[model samples]
Target: MRRRFKLATLTAALCLLLVSLSGCGQSLAQKDILQLDRHSNEITWGVKADTKLFGLMDVRDNQIKGFDVDMAKHITKHILGTKGQAKFIQVTSQSRIPLLKNGNIDAIIATMTITPERAKIVDFSNSYFDAGQSLLVPNGSDIKNVRDLNKPGMTVLGVVGANSVQNIKKYAPKARVLELQDYAQALTSLKAGQGQALTTDNGILYGMAVQNPGFKVVGGTFTKEPYGVAVNKGQRPFVREINKAIKEMQADGEYNALIKKWFGNVPGFNYKELER
Candidate 1:
């Protein structure tokens, strides 16, 4: 009888071990996504603090504000309950993904494009916003559209991680491409006459035009750039939560309100096109 009792005790411990392992089978990102409400009820989102309209730091209060800011807060509340807290971390195009991978940030909503190349490493929520590539040039320049940028001497300024330079080459093979550190630098270079034109999403270009009087977005859009919220690869739970929150926002009219709040007043942009 004592031998049988010992065997039963061993079996019980093995069963307990299996149960514990099963509960912890999830990765950190997955576990965090699942216990969003219980585990501190706080989420840190990576966003652009320099890119205007999408996400930028408001100097007055030293807080990041813009379309991405509002969306992150909205989604955080939706997923983690109304009392959920969202901490914002500024990340650039070159650094956002790495930060997400290293567990520094929970998700990326910094106007990032949902490209297949990016998908191999990170999981992206459904396209939350639709955008397109366009050009910003000094007012009255000879370059009127994408077709006019094919000259051999025409230099196009782009940001480091932006795919605009590649698309620009496809659209204007003869044009020279100059990559800068960020959009602000790219715009500064364009204003300094380093490049004939700056290329990025039209929404970003519009923000630049608002800040600089003599530059305008021209050539319409050459490529669709659908913005998405991204999380680490294998974080399907996190991605699904984001997608669900986005749909909820759309159905509840919150998405339209946000679009109207930011893009509504943007000059040369048709905000109606962004309505849900």
Candidate 2:
């Protein structure tokens, strides 16, 4: 009788453990993200709150406003309708991926570039904005282009977790690269003369130049930096919906309108080239 009781207790405990494991698995399973957003009527986005044109924090009401924010709003409407809410969460270059992976945000649209490495962990939608790696320097600095940075003793400023930093190493193998926390810090370091040139996407540099008349983007663009909307690893449905929305926006000239709205006034940047 005693043995039977012990066996029965053990079996029950084992059953409970299996049940708990199954529940946890279900919780972690790939969800239909599109349907989830529709049901909730909201899509939370991780965006940069410091990068000027792509995503910037407007001090007026402490709200983030930029091209990325507007794009996310339009995408939310396409996914969940006009009534759906688009919630923005501020993210830095280092925090965006971790936030997305931990489910803190539904998607990331913070001027993130799609790369073979990033695609392994997070799925990216079709390229929404075409950008390219370039250099931002003081108005009369001698650094004219990437080739000039190839010389020894040149210090290049870059934002941490940015692909631009990685690309710079290829173009300027002899120059030392200093990675800052974000665009704000990088630009500050440049102003303080800590680095010779700040490197990033041209669109972002153009925005910075617009704000700081003393700085300018030079060297044209050495490498393509196509921006994309990122979702979790298994969210193909959500990616497809975003791609569809982009196609619709482009076909109806909404995409071009947004391009003009943000980049039209940027000095020296050919915004028309971006219009689709």
Scored by lDDT, the top model is 2
Q: Lowest-scoring 10 consecutive residues by lDDT in candidate 2? A: 24-33
Error of 1 at 78 (Å): 0.5
Q: Which stretches of candidate 2 lie over 4 Å from their true place?
A: 1-26
Q: Give each prediction's root-mean-square deviation over alpha carbons.
A: 7.8, 3.5
* Cα-lDDT of candidate 1: 0.89
The local lDDT score (0 to 100) that residue 210 gets in candidate 2 is 90
Instruction: Provide the overall lDDT of each model, using Cα atoms, as 2-decimal numbers.
Output: 0.89, 0.92
Model 1 poorest 10 in a row by lDDT = 29-38
Clashing pairs in 1: none
Q: Hey, what RMSD does candidate 1 come out at?
A: 7.8
TM of each candidate vs. truth: 0.88, 0.92
Give one digit per residue, the lDDT tens place, for model 2 in 1-276.
999999999999999999999887577556777888889999999999998888999898998988999999998888788899999999999999999977889999999999999999999999999999999999989888999999888999999999999999999999999999999999999999999999999999999999999999998999999999999977888999999999988998889889999999888899988888
